[model samples]
Target chain A: MAEFYSLRVNGVDREVVDAQLGESLLFVLRERLGLLGTKGACEQGECGSCSVLVDGELVCACLVLAAAQSGRDIVSIEGIAPAGVSTDVQQAFVDAGAVQCGFCTPGLVMAAHSLLERIVDPTDTEIREELSGNICRCTGYGRLVEAVANVAKTRIALGGNRG
Target chain B: MTVSVPTSVAEAVSLLAAAPDSLVLAGGTDLMVEVNAGHRSLDRVIAVDRIEELRDWSISADRRSLTIGSGVPYSLVMDGPIAELVPALAQASRTVGSPQIRHVGTIGGNLGTCSPAGDTLPVLAALDAQIHLRSVSGGRTVSFSHFMTGVKRNSRQPDELITGVTLPVLPGWQGYSKVGVRNAMVIATASSCLAVDESTRSVRVALGSVGPVIIRCTDAEDWVVGQIDWERRAVDDGVVAEFGQRCGVAARPIDDHRSTAAYRRRAIEVLSARQLRRAFPNG
Candidate 1:
């Protein structure tokens, strides 16, 4: 049975009708709401290509059920920056050449965004651990690590609120 | 199809009683994988992670033990006081999946999954933790050894749910370690936990992923007592090697997708010795 679900996604209350019972949040975001920024590669939560923020907690969106997210807040990569603009983390990724195929860029950006939100000035070990779930096979981890580190340094200098 | 997200343990029990065939979802780390793969279609599901009572945990009376709710995530167990109470469990939690997985996976779910390789089981066995079970009829507790019957198998009845696990607070040294293809987010190819009880001058060692159930090495444990000097609180390098060798021999490892039987046997032997020495290192 399909039902209507109203979820506060990306700072907006979006109504989704015809919601299937076992539909994943990744599917709802991409297919239902048309928020295609959150990519879906491996639906089994192995690849973090579908990473997103559920009430400020970073998780694999593919692993979460849309129905279970009744009143929760979800922030996808599409809402990470202002309209027609890129956030520092996203910009840093392009500057550092961390976007190879670009399929994993959204997930990496979202994960880094959430990490900076919580830790502010994170160490290399902390940054690596936070982004462990998100895999970028083509880009390799070095560039992504550098991009996140670059953003972290600037965010710290900016009083750590910029991400 | 109906998915029940109960706010309390009582509500969850009632929901299950009404639908005995309902699948229990915790963390959804393991279950959702199968669901996404189209291996099994679930018509009825009960999400237990949301129930607050299922996540409740606290120190036991007399301060000699700790009671952990079934829904307590691995991250909490790693950061909270529970980690300090059982260092082996904390060590195991740190190695389970990645940060995202740890944020949701619970010890109770590990028990519910009952995978022989699930990292938490060996620690629970080493600690001799008590499995708390609940049903619409009543509640009961069982030892970890008795709770696990076989690989992905347990004595849990269809109508029963795991409420929590209670483990003793060991004042002595204890630790856990595993051998995986990679360190960050790989399942244990072979794992071992060692706990030293100074009061009895005894040690408990358990191996996982190398048998149908986590193997408790009584033979190795007995030798550990004889080998370690109570007064010196130390054991020779040879004694440690022999102890690990004995424990490894007791495991019934088989060739699996992750590793071969011969390799798992050797890995357990090396891991057991390494964890034992780390817990009771010579200064």
Candidate 2:
């Protein structure tokens, strides 16, 4: 029942071998492809810890079939930045003290990236709503919201450039 | 296990007919939950999201009906011409899970799951939308009332695939409301959709999560239609309260983990009354 397939992730074509069709995209990404940045918490879509962008749309990787994502473009946490390089959102998280346990950071970062990509200068309410799917057990949402808002403000100051 | 990715409706249906037990995967919002929980195992899954025919939608030439494809995601329903034509559907779509969930969850998935708490069910029921199904055998359309059989149950056959739903675009106002544990990322404990058709001088109300299936409050609908002045879009406060009471009486909620039966019944009354007032601002 194992299948072989290739998925375009982070602009790279990666081949997955001997994977169960029932295995989730989250499992395949972490276990098969060695992409551990996307955390698996609550296995269900509720936790949002497994958030990823498949075809530029934010979704819970735990809720997607590994084989079904064959032809789709997937962007994982590890793919978002250069090796050991943090983006503005990641830097903002550190500046705003948004990283506590760090388990939810990657998912939160992905959600924040998705929001800013669509709405460069998102309001506080928009940021909160966009990140609502992600849960930080540390209960550090206030700081997370602040981090996203600061990034949005910086982007606005730069004339809507997501640099 | 094997997975089939069909790019067309014909291929999808033929695959289903060939392998009737093939699990249909759309958004994976519900099926993945079960899979992750280890409650079910998939031997064969047919991914239908790739079918462009199931993703496309079209409006009737007369502008009286809007047919939404099964694979149309809730995010598309949140805002657009579809939202303008069926505001109630948009409202219901907004209440489904979260922004991430809305991105992939499809109306057809909601219909396939047929959970009583499915947000879009009440709106579809109130609108009297027709569910279209197709198989290698043929195609047939079923009304929303008969489509859902019970909680997480439907009339869809193993060989049939839900192609789309046709909703009538009425002139009058329509809206959807729900009460959950919290504002976002929560399932509805109780929900209601109220829609009015000025052309037909009719009022329709449907309740969700308070019954085994989407409960159409015919008593309340018939009573409200008589009480409202269609030309003025007005009704009496007492009439609205009575309609709400009737809607509450129609609920078949049970005490469960999500909510108490009494609370669900009360939520239905409050939701129906509020929706009735909002629809008839002059009340």
Candidate 3:
């Protein structure tokens, strides 16, 4: 068995079971750390359900090894809220009625949050492109796109704050 | 076995050379999928993401070529300095999977995976890109044509890790096109890339997912180049369509779940024609 290590998740340091050489980050998060907000859908990299932020870059946790994340800051959907109400992106999803079926909402929120981090004022096309990896079976992505765009606009209007 | 995350190129090379059975993992976009699907069997994995040396990218001092780090992500290739140097490659990179996949997937991973449907393979084949490989022993370069062996296979030794891909900086027009079920996050049914060199009065066309490896349509390229009267006439639609048909015929596709051989062949023809038109719009 490999030695366990301390990992920074959502700014909190927690010890996690050391991952085997090839164990995916998704498995470690869901199975080991019990961070269930990061869903595991289509273990294949196609679906964005396992999406997470590693050092601020959006990556498919299902496609990345847990060992590769050493010394990196990881942010999962569970980490999105430190206090209470969900992140602005999550709130926008509800306000825009973009949460349908809800399985893909966390992934969509994480993807949208990643986009907002890079571009506070993303165009509709950019938002669509960023969210392309995330699949929303119920909403058909019409409202999801709107939600992301709305969040981007709100972020910019608030001088880059969701508060 | 424990995974080794080497921080430098030398460390990575040493580790790989020491344990020839260790697998090199960059991006892990393809490898992880294979492993999770039980398609690949491996006992030891070496994570290459932390190797800063492999991530170094810069143009040669001569300014006659571009050296792209094997670890550079597809997103960087699509929007970074490499885009200006190799527009066709950038265009192809843009069509790989989606933004998330692009953010993590590396061109080196594409080469290492060596899939016939690799979006960037056709462009590299058409551009005659060179792959730089290194091991504890030393370094050597191989042409794109020689690097890939067959579907999901390559000639790279287990101990050798790709360091960079070098593409010559030349003045020419290039175009790439891929046919898939949908516009986003779909693998290529068939793809083609075309490069037209007005100075040499030559053209190069490479097709993917239509054969075991990216195939060059030398006969059709020569035929098109011979027929083009660059100064007097433009390349007509009929000529372009004929070129596309010839390029399509060069492919040997097989029926698969994603698409049928017939559909892939037909798509090859259309993609070939469209790419030629885009590469040589005036002709």
Candidate 4:
């Protein structure tokens, strides 16, 4: 059974037509909406390559049903930046050389943004725990952790709303 | 395939009664995996995640128990007042997948699945929690021991929805421990939770991934209670090793892909002993 539905992704309502009930939010975001930035690896929730923010809470998009998330506010990698500008967290990733294959960067960015939004100055343990879902097969966790911590310190110095 | 989103418990139950075969979708942490893996088919789905009634939690009038809504995610249990009330549950919550999974994964989802390896089941079993279920026909509460029937199976009827769980606020230390291949985002090879009740002067020990369902070690619990000095809140060093041995012997694990049966039994023993020692540090 295929039905039509609309999702508010990145503050815009996108219509999905004739989607199967089994279609996940990750599938719809990439294939239907042409939002290829949200990668889909290991379609199961284990990889965290499809991590996205649903209603401002981080979740693996692959685990969410597209139809069920119709009315929720979804923020993907494409929406993370403000008008084509990279946020401090994204810049920190570049400065720290956290990108290797660049496949897990979008999801990692989403996870980092979600963490910094809730905790302005998170500890190293907190950063590791929060980013645990987004696995960097490149094994760039040392620099990834550093990037997030640096951004956290920068956020505190800037005094709020910098994420 | 139709996805029905109900706003309240009444509507959800009515929808379930109308379509008993309707698959209930909460967090989709477990269900979507099966669907993605081509293990389960989805047609009519009743999405209850948005229902406000299922997301709210409250304390009893007497403050003797806390009733957490089935839809309350593990993140809520990992901190704040609920964590203060049930530290074992908080510890278990922290061990669940990661922050992303914890933000959406609910304790109700764990109960609804009833997998033998579910991280939260052992803690719920040790606490002697009561599961609340509702249907268009009526409502009833089942004890944790009776609720889980077998691996990935429960006593819940097709039309009945799990509403919440009520756990007593025991006046004692409680802790949870598990052994997995990795520290984070890894499923437990064997997990154990030990809760000590000062008022009853009794101990409750539960193990996961070591039996058909969450196993409560009645023999170990009774034996350990006798070894402990209730007044001094201590236990003899000689008795702790034997307690661990008893818990290991009680496990009914099998050789699975995740681990060997013998290793799971041994892990349960080690986890149980460590949890007991943590609960009674003076000993």
Candidate 5:
């Protein structure tokens, strides 16, 4: 039996139908809600393509069941830049030529955003550690790290979390 | 296909007892991986992550042990108070899947899966951790060694739920080392943990991903403890080499797809020696 779930996604109260709590939140967001920013790949939790923030903690959406997340706050990549407005991390990625295939871009952006929020200025090692979970199959990681480092500098100069 | 999200351990225990074969979902890191890969069919699941009681922890009144809830996430266990008590477990937890995986993966899930490569198992074995399990029938505790019988196999009855694990906080130095093809986000090709008890003047070494279950080198432990000065945390090169040799000998590695038997044995030796050096850095 399917149940209705009301999820606080991207600062909006969204309702999803035919919600199988057993299904991944990724399915609900992409297929049901039609918010495709949070990519789904390697559904085994190895790929961070489906990374999202549930109550401010970053988790792989594929590994997390929807039923377990009812009435919870979820911040996806789509929500990170409200109303399609670009975030600093997004701009930095474009400026630094970080995206090659662009499939892993959203997740990397979100992961980098999460780090910058906490670590206003992260070292190269910290950036590597934080973003290692989000794989860029195109092997554009060197520029990805450079882009994230570039944004961290901008965020620190602008004085913190929200720029 | 029922997904029961029990808010309490008692409810979970009853649900699991009612459905003996129901999969107990802690972090869902391993179970979901199997489900996604079409490796196993998940019929019914008892999701225990929501149970707050299963996520709590407390140190023994005698101050000799720490008991962490089965549902405690690796992120929590690897940081702050828990890490202070068992640094070896903390280091092992840090090496688990990734930040996203660690955010939700629990010590209980590592035990439940009973994978020989499980990063926590070797640490638990070295610490001689006691696993506490409960069911509607009754509650009992088992040694970490006794709990895991084989790869992805455990003595845990379907009706039973892991309540928590009680690890003795011996006055000692603890260290862990894991070898993998990549620096991050890769499972251990081979891993080893070394825990030295200062009070008892004992040394225990456990090798991971090199056998059917976490292999504790009892002879090597006795040899290392006997050879080293417990007070100074000092050991000669010969003692370290002999201890590593024993660990290499004890590892029952095979030519699995992940690694060759010879490479796995060599890794055990290298990791064992490195972890011992870390446990007694000055030595």
Candidate 6:
């Protein structure tokens, strides 16, 4: 018998079906929900390519079971920016040219969003530490660091305090 | 085909006792990794992350003991007042995977996994921490040393879940060091944790990844404790060399892809001496 679970994705209630016993949330989102923004790379949790926010906590989607996420709120990278509009972090990534191959961009952006949510004005060291789980083969992380730092500076200039 | 998310400790205990085969899930860091790698099979998972009762934490009335929730995240340990309580644990927590891993990984997860290379295992062993287990039957506490028996094996039964961990509010300096292939997001090739109790003038050291289970250097600990009066003698070239050799003898490493037994043996000496020196700066 197939099991179904209710999940809140991007503030919208959705019924996820055919959540097999061992199917990962990454597979369900990409295969079922068609949320391809959450890439599946290194299916092992080593690379943060499948990062997502489950109940406001960033976790490797590849490591989370779809069944385990029942009744939980999940935010994927696609939900962060809506209708051709990019978030400040995403904009910073573009301005800093942090995207190269772009395979790691979604995960990096999700991780950066999680970091910025907790820390409004993060230092260079803090940003690096927060995104250490994310592995990017291309661009060597310099622009990514600059991207997060740029958002931090912008938030501070806008009179926002670091959480 | 039962999935239970108990809101309280009592509820969780009751559910666990009802289904002894139920797999307890907290943080799901290690379990998820194994499941993803096809190393684990699970049909019944009991999520304990939301049970507020097990997440309770408090300092003992005497201020000499601290009881921390088993579900407390390592990131919390690295951030707040809890870090001050156990600096070695905080340092070890920093070595766990990375920020996201620490943010989600719980100390209970580390204890439940019972891996020798677990960043917090050696520190818990050096601190002589206690594991608090609870079931529908009742509650029982065991020493960390006795709780862990082998690699990834523990005395905890399927019907029981870890409630919390308790350790004496240490009254001295504690240090932890890990030698891994990389500084970030890497497992330890060999790790050592050393704690110096000035109140009792005792020193305890535990080594990880060099044995089937985390091993303590009783001889070196005793030697350092005995030489407290002779601080200069304790740090002497001969004493350091002897301590290192004894630590190496205590390890029983195996040749794996991460490293060879020979390399791990040598690393035990170097890391043990370094941690000991850091803990006993005067020596």
lDDT of 3: 0.86
Could you give candidate 5's per-residue lDDT for residues B12-109 as a string of tens digits? 98998888989899998888887767787667888898899988999999989999999999989887998998898899998898888888899999
- Where model 6 places Cα greater than 4 Å from the true spot, the runs are A161-163, B229-234
Q: Which stretches of candidate 3 lie over 4 Å from their true place?
A: A1-3
TM of chain B, each: 0.98, 0.99, 0.96, 0.98, 0.97, 0.95
Collision count of model 2: 1
Question: For all the predictions, what are the DockQ values?
Answer: 0.64, 0.84, 0.74, 0.82, 0.65, 0.57
Candidate 3 CAPRI-style tier: medium
**Interface RMSD in angstroms for candidate 2:** 0.8
Better of 2 and 5 by lDDT: 2
- Write out fnat for all predictions, comma-separated: 0.41, 0.80, 0.71, 0.76, 0.57, 0.43
Q: All candidates' TM-scores?
A: 0.96, 0.98, 0.96, 0.98, 0.95, 0.95
Candidate 4: TM-score? 0.98
In model 5, where do residues sit more than 4 Å from their true spots?
A1-6, A19-21, B281-283
Candidate 2 residue B175 C-alpha distance from true site, Å: 0.8
Give residue B33's error in model 4 in angstroms: 0.3
RMSD for each model, in Å, please?
A: 1.7, 1.2, 1.6, 1.1, 1.9, 2.1
TM-score of 2: 0.98
Sort by TM-score, top down from the best: 4, 2, 3, 1, 6, 5
lDDT of 5 by residue, A1-163 (tens): 7777677888888888886656777888898899898999899888899999988878888888776676678999888866768888888888898988889888888788788767778899989988889988785589999998898777667776556
Q: Residue B222, candidate 3: how far off, in angstroms? A: 1.0
In terms of docking quality, model 1 is medium
Every candidate's lDDT: 0.87, 0.93, 0.86, 0.91, 0.87, 0.84
Model 3, range B108-174, lDDT digits (tens) per residue?
A: 9999999999999999899899999999999999999999999988989999999889987667778
**Residue pairs with clashing backbones, model 2:** A1-B1
